[model samples]
Target: MGAPGGYGTGFALIVVLFILLVIVGAGILRF
Candidate 1:
């Protein structure tokens, strides 16, 4: 998926945000 340019940057950002949301949701449930 290394086509270079803006595509990879956007994809990575989306993946990071998704992971962060999952972690926050799990923490809230535990509390």
Candidate 2:
């Protein structure tokens, strides 16, 4: 079922992952 809600959820998940990766990278660089 390719519903509109599914797309929105997937996009949100990707965005969250990207933000987390950025934070982790910054922390590693700080060390």
Candidate 3:
């Protein structure tokens, strides 16, 4: 699974983006 699991990075990036968006939304709501 050397180069076969390269897609994991893309999925991880997407997850990170989602978390960031959620955090930003929470901050906006709090203000």
Candidate 2, overall lDDT?
Answer: 0.95
Kindly list the per-residue Cα lDDT of model 2 for residues 1-31, writing each as its tens digit. 5669989899999999999999999999998
lDDT of model 3 at position 13: 90
| Error in Å for residue 19 of model 1 | 0.2
- The better candidate by lDDT, 1 or 3, is 1
Over the full model, what C-alpha lDDT does candidate 3 score relative to the true structure?
0.89
Instruction: Using lDDT, rank the candidates from best to worst.
Output: 2, 1, 3
Off by over 4 Å in 2: 1-3
How many clashes does the backbone of model 3 have?
0
Ranking by TM-score: 2, 1, 3
lDDT of 1 by residue, 1-31 (tens): 5597788889899999999999999999999
Where does model 3 exceed 4 Å of error? 1-3
**What is the TM-score (0 to 1) of candidate 2?**
0.87
Candidate 2 — worst ten consecutive residues by lDDT sum? 1-10
TM-score of predicted model 3?
A: 0.79
